[model samples]
Target: MSDYEISNVDPNQELAEQGSDNFWLIAAIGLGLTTIGIGIKDFFTSRKLKQEREKNKLYQEVLKKHQAQINELKNEKERREYRDRLWAENSN
Candidate 1:
């Protein structure tokens, strides 16, 4: 029998049997890897958002304390100025 001779008469059907199983196996592995990658990305994104929220809270607290100090200084300066004006007017 020659190497190219198949006992079956349908040439189109024999060609369809070549390497189709290998193609499907490779496609399934690729889909599994893509699913794992998306899961890992979501895990890291959630962690980063949590850290950013903590940092923002710390920054707000520091800003509030600085504003309080500024207001106290302004009030002290105004009191000093009023006292100086009163002393000068009473002496004249």
Candidate 2:
């Protein structure tokens, strides 16, 4: 018998052997890593949303205070003048 025979070589059999051995393990690890990444993404998204809500709440309170100050202005002219100044100051 010859040591190296081209007719005896089977590429499909070698591929099947390799695939059967590690396919499930590789698939499970990939799924686990994907799950972890999604969880981390969700956690950060929730944290950012909570921070935004808190910032909005603080902004609302400041806005109410400014409105009250503007309303207390005695005349329309003063109110409009102060309103313009307030907008410019806040925008900066």
Candidate 3:
């Protein structure tokens, strides 16, 4: 007979004596805590995203105003050049 031979002892006896340790209860508590942490992280992430979106909108509005001013300046310069050419042609 080898020392590693299988015995006829009940496998559940040791667990029963140790009160089974409520493994399912501990697992449920850990799962619930993990879910709450994920929810909190999601909430903060969405809030930051919203803030960034609003900032982008404001920047776009400012850029549009600047572009309009630049277009006005370009038009004025073209008008002056056209007027100068017409005056020179009439004098000649």
**lDDT for every model?**
0.91, 0.92, 0.91
lDDT of 3 by residue, 1-92 (tens): 65455476678888986665667777889999999999999999999999999999999999999999999999999999999999999999
User: CA shift at 33, candidate 1, in angstroms?
Assistant: 1.1
Each prediction's TM-score against the native? 0.74, 0.60, 0.74
**Cα misplacement distance, residue 48 of candidate 3 (Å):** 0.3
TM-score of predicted structure 3:
0.74
Clash pairs of candidate 1?
none
Question: Quick one: ranking by lDDT, best first?
Answer: 2, 3, 1
Superposition error at 40 for model 1 (Å): 0.8
* lDDT value for model 1: 0.91
Query: Cα lDDT of model 2 overall?
Result: 0.92
**Which scores better on lDDT, 2 or 3?**
2
Please list the residue runs of candidate 3 whose C-alpha ends up more than 4 Å from where it truly belongs after superposition.
1-21
The C-alpha RMSD of each candidate to the native structure, in angstroms, is 4.6, 12.6, 7.0
Candidate 3 structure lDDT: 0.91
